[model samples]
Target: MGRKNDIASAVIMLGVALFLAGCPKQALEPVGAGGPQPQAQPQQESPAMTPEQPAMQMEPYGGASGQGAVRLDQARQDFQDADIMFEYDSFSLTAEAKKVLAEKARFLNAHPGMKVLIEGHCDERGTAEYNLALGERRAKAAQEYLVFLGVNAQRLSTISYGEEKPLDPEANEAAWAKNRRAHFVITEG
Candidate 1:
């Protein structure tokens, strides 16, 4: 009985030793042969540039000549919302243009007192007179669409700037496409 008890105790001790040997170390010790271990630290990040950052090139706008005027930022937003476009020498609105005009009309209808001036533009392709006429047609097209969409005609007007007010002055297809557009300007109280 004494021998059996000794054997059992030896077996238990052997099992515990094996189990501990197989387990991962709970405490880490620094190695004397190598340098100190690196401490974890938060990484520093570079500053990010945002839209509020100053533009490289800024154009200056003169003060309003009339009684009531719209903010330049608001005008820009209106122009974006308008999205008026024309085909080569065509005054008719495309399906997409009509959709955009519908939204514009809805906006104008909502703001009954607001007045908008549509400025017709042209690419530097046709004769000055022809371009002017084309511009008028384009502006009128947008104005008519607004009227059709229930915006009061009395609250809207059209102007033909022709090729004079080119959004992109470059003589490329992209510039031409950009220049050939009908833009919005708020001209009244």
Candidate 2:
């Protein structure tokens, strides 16, 4: 009976050992030359992904105290020869517009005694009131830039004709672009 009991206990121990051997092994340390794998890097955020700001921001023009003598004929000529373009539905001057204005400024500086009126115009897109406002904005932008470029504020005046005066009369992009401008007319002459 003792021998039988001993044999049963030995069988039970063998079964326990087989069960543990069949179980999966836990990894105690990293494997080969690759070692511990590095974690994936997070993606960087981009400025382009963000929404843009509003377009109506007006920069302040430092007033006209630093002006010099300018040529009248040259200024008039430059004003006549200057070509300014605006974006669709906008009166803001682009880099090209700025370059033209700079030349105009040089002319104005040469002719200091010349007093001119800047006529603001717009294409026939919106209501008269809206167009008038846009035209005024264009005129004011030109005037302010001139002031910044050392042209006397007193010599510069602004007016808005809105869509009333169409330079091309044709209802096309070129005509509309032509209409959306700040034209100079010598008011004091």
lDDT for every model? 0.64, 0.62
- Candidate 2 stretches with Cα past 4 Å from truth are 1-75
CA shift of 55, model 1, Å: 40
* Model 2 residue 65 CA deviation in Å: 37
How many times do residue backbones clash in model 1?
Answer: 0
Q: Give the per-residue lDDT digits (tens) of candidate 2, residues 1-189.
A: 999999998877655333222211100011122222111111222221212211111011111111101122343465775657677668888999899889888766644446788888888877899989988899999999999999989999999999999788998888888888888876653
Q: Of the candidates shown, which would achieve the greatest lDDT relative to the real structure?
A: 1
* TM-score computed on alpha carbons, candidate 2: 0.58
lDDT of model number 2: 0.62
TM-score of each model, in listed order = 0.58, 0.58
Instruction: Give the clash total for candidate 2.
Output: 7
